[model samples]
Target: MAREYLNVRVDADLKKQLQKLAKRENRTLSNLVETVLGNYAKRKSS
Candidate 1:
C-alpha cells in the first residue's frame, strides 16, 4: 500500500507519551499513529 506524508503539530508532552507507548509496544511511530487514527475514525463513525 502507498502512504502519503501528513504534517501535524502536537505538544511536547503528547509526543513524549506517544514515543514511550511505541517503545513499550514495539511499534513504530507510524503504526502507532495509524492505530490511533483508525480507532478515532471508528468511534466518530459510530
Candidate 2:
C-alpha cells in the first residue's frame, strides 16, 4: 500500500507516554500510531 506523510503536534507528556508504550511493544512510534489509528478507524466504521 502507498503511504502518505502526516504531521501532528502533540503535548510533550503524551509524546513521552507514547514513546514508552512503543518501546514496550517493540514498535516504532510511527508504527504504534498507525496501528492505533487503524484500530480506531475499524471501530468507528463498525
Q: Per-candidate TM vs. native?
A: 0.86, 0.97
Residue-level lDDT of model 1, residues 1-46, one tens digit each, is 8988888999999999999999999999878999999999999999
TM value for model 1: 0.86
lDDT, residue 17, model 2: 100
Write one digit per residue (lDDT tens) for candidate 2, span 1-46: 9999999999999999999999999999999999999999999999
Candidate 1's C-alpha runs over 4 A off are none
Determine which window of 10 residues in candidate 2 has minimal summed lDDT: 3-12
In candidate 2, residue 31 scores what lDDT?
100
User: Model 1 Cα displacement at 29 (Å)?
Assistant: 1.3
In model 2, which regions exceed 4 Å deviation? none
- Where does candidate 1 clash, by residue pair? none
TM-score of 2: 0.97
In Å, residue 6's CA in model 2 sits off its true spot by: 0.6
